[model samples]
Target: MQNVTVKNRNWDIAAHMYFPEPFDQSKKYSAIVCVHPGSSVKEQTAGLYAEKLAQTGFITLAFDASFQGESGGVPRYLEDPATRVEDIRCAVDYLTTVTFVDENRIGVLGICAGGGYAANAALTERRIKVVGTVVATNAGRAFGELNPLQTLEAVSKQRTAEARGADAMITSWTPDSAEEAERAGLAEFDMLEAIDYYRTPRGSYPTSCNKLRFTSMSALITFDAFHYAERLLTQPLMVIVGDKVGAFGSYRDGFDLYNKAASSNKRIHVVHGASHYDLYDQPEATGQALEKLIPFYKENL
Candidate 1:
C-alpha cells in the first residue's frame, strides 16, 4: 500500500493506494474507491477492504474524509454530508489522473454511512461505473431521532458561542469503553460491537477519532443521502447487508436502496449471521462480502 494525498477542494485527503500483487504499471487496471464508515479513518476497515480488493487484481484506494481522520479541514472532526459526498468524487478525480488506471472501469465501495455518501454521489457522478455498499447506513435517517429544527437551533447557539470565544462542542459517537457503555446503559448489540471494534486495540488507530463537531449535526439531521435515489441512482448497484440488523439500520437502508433504485442491473446480498459491525473487520463476514463483490466489479467495472 502506498500512502497518498487526494485533493478535495482546498483540503488534502490522506489515503492509501493498494496495488495488485506483481503489479505492472504498463497495464491499465480497474480501480475501486473504498470509503470508510462515519467517524473512521483510512487506517481502519476501509483500508482493510482496499488491501483485500487489491489482492484480487484491482487497484483500490481507501481515503480519509476531508474534515476527519488525517485529512485537512478547519473545525477538525466535522462530518458534513455534502462534503462527504464530494470527497468520493475527489477520490475519483485523483484516480482518473493515474497512468495505470482505466478511468472507465472505476467503481466505489462504501461501508456504513460512507455507503450512503457513495450512493448520493453516484446519483450525479456518472464516472463511477458501478457502486457497492456494505452494511449501508443512511446517516440522515440515522440522525432522524433528533428533530431537525431543534438540532439546528442548538447548532446555531453552539456556533454563536464559538464565535464569542467559547470552545467547540465535541461529542463522542460511542462510549470510551465497553465497561463505560455498560455502565451508561448503552447495551444495544450494535453499540457494544462498535465499542469493541473502535474503542479498543482490535481496530482503534490514533487517527480514528470517534468524536464529531457539534455544528456538524445540523447538516446531518437535514441531509438525505438517498434522496431521489429511485430516479437518479441509475448506475449498476450492489447492496450488501447483514441478516442481523441492529440499531444502525443499515439492513433496512440496503433493502430500501435495492428496491428503490431505477437501475436495471442491481442486486442485494445478505450475509447470514453477520451483524452491522461484523462486516467491519470480521474475516468470515468480510470474506462472504468479497465473494459477491469480486465478481460484481469484475463483470460491471
Candidate 2:
C-alpha cells in the first residue's frame, strides 16, 4: 500500500493505493477507486476492500473525502454530497495519471453513503467504466426522511452563527459507544452495530472522528445522489446489500439503484442475514460482497 495525495480543486485528498502483489510497472492494470462512507476515513472498510481487490490483480485506491479525515479542507468534518461526488472524480483523475493504471478500465466501489456518491459521480464521469456499491445509502433520501425542512432551517442558523465568529456546530453520526446507545435507548439493530463499529477500536481510526459539521445537513437534505441515474448512469453496475434492512435505508437504496440505473448489465446481490453494518467489516459479510464484486469488476472493467 502506498500513501498518496490527489489534487481536488483547492484541497488535496489523502489516499492509499494498493498494488497487485506481483506488480509490474511496465504493464497497465484495471483500477478501482474505493469511496468510504460518510464520516469515515480511508483506513476503514474502503481500504479493506481496496487491499483485497489489489490481491486479486486490480490496482485500488481508498481516499479520504475532502474536509474529513486527513484531507485538506476548512470547516472540517463537512459532508457535502456534491463535494463527495467530485472527490471520486478527482480520485479517478489521480488514477489516470498513474503509469500502471489502465485508464479505460477504471471502476469505482462505494460503501454506504459513498455508494450513493459513486453512483452520482458515474452518472457523468464516463471515465468510470464500472460501478459497485455495498450496502448503499442514499444520503439525501436518508436525511430527507427526517424533518428536512426543520433541519435545513436549523442548519441555516448554524452556518450564520459560524460565519459570525461562533464555533462551528458539530454532531456525531452515532452515539459514542454501545453503552451510550443503550443508555440513549437506541435499540435499532443497525444503529447499535454502527456504534460498535465507529466508536470502538473494532473499526475506529484517529482521523475518523465521527464528527459531522451541523451545517452540512442543509446540502444533504437537498442533494439527490441518484438524480439522473436512469438517464446517465449507463456503465455496468453491481449493487450489494445485506438482507437485514436498517433504519438508514441501505437495503432499500441498493434495490432502488438496481432498478433505476440505466445500465444494460446490472445486478443486486444480498448477503444473507447480514445487517448494513455487518458488511462494513464482518469477514463473512464482506467476503460475500467481494465474491460478487471481484467477478463483476473482472467482467466489466
Candidate 3:
C-alpha cells in the first residue's frame, strides 16, 4: 500500500494507491477512483473496493475527504455536498497526471454516501468516462429539505447560524463505544452492523481520517446531491443497491434519479437478499455486484 498526497480544488487531498505487487510503472492502466462514505475513511469498505479493483488489472485510489481522516481542512467532518462532489473530481483530476493511468479510461466507484458524490460528479465532469455506485445515496433527499425530519425553517436557521460563524457542534449518529451504545439516541440507527465495521478491528485502521464534528449536522442538512442529476444523461451510469435496508429507504432512489438523467446509458442492479452493508464487503455479494459492474464499464468506458 503506497500513500501519496494530491491537491484538490480547495483542499490538499490524501490518497492511497494500490497497484499489482509487481508495480509496473510504464503501463497506462485504466483507473478507478473510490469515494468513501459519510463519517468514514478511505480504509473502510471503499478502500477495500479500491484494492480489489486494483487487483483486477486497473489502477485504483481511495482517499480521505477534506476535513476528515488524513485529509486537510480546518472545520473537521464538515459535510459540504458541493465540496464532496468536487472531491471526486479532484481524485479524477489527480489521476490524470499519473503516468500509470490512461486518462480517457478513468472510472469511479462510490460507496454509501460516496456513491452520491460519484454520481453527482459524473453529471458535469466528462473526464469521468465510466461510473458505478454501490449502496448509493441520494444526498438531496438525505439532507436539507430532503431529510423527512428536517424542515425548511430548520435549514434556514442552521444556514444562518453557520453563516454567522457559529461554533458548530455537530452531533454524531454512530455510537462512540459500548457505553455509548447503551446511551444511543435513535432506535432504527443503533444497529450493531455498523458498529462491527466501524469500531471493531474487522475494518478500523489508525490512519483512517475520521473525525466526527459537531457541525456536521448543520452542514449535512444543507447539502443536496440530486439538484442537477437530470443533466447527467449524456454519459453512462451504473447503480447497485441492496435488496434490504430497513433504515435506508432511499438507498436506491438515486438509481431511479440517474435513469431519468439525460444519460445515454444507465443501469440499476438490485442484489438479491442483500442488506446495505452486505453489499459493502460480503464476499459473495460483492463478487456478484462487481460481475455486473465489470461488464458495464468494459462496454461503456
Off by over 4 Å in 2: none
How accurate locally, in lDDT, is each candidate?
0.92, 0.92, 0.75
Q: Of the candidates numbered 2 and 3, which has the greater TM-score value?
A: 2
Clashes by residue pair, model 2: none
- RMSD in Å for model 3: 3.0
After superposition of all CA atoms, the RMSD between model 2 and the true structure is 1.0
Query: Which runs in model 1 stand beyond 4 Å of their true positions?
Result: 147-149
Ranking by lDDT: 2, 1, 3
The TM-score values for the models, in the order shown, are: 0.97, 0.98, 0.86
Put down candidate 3 lDDT per residue, 170-249, tens digits, no spaces. Answer: 56546655556667543354245566667778767775433555445555665555556776545688888877765654
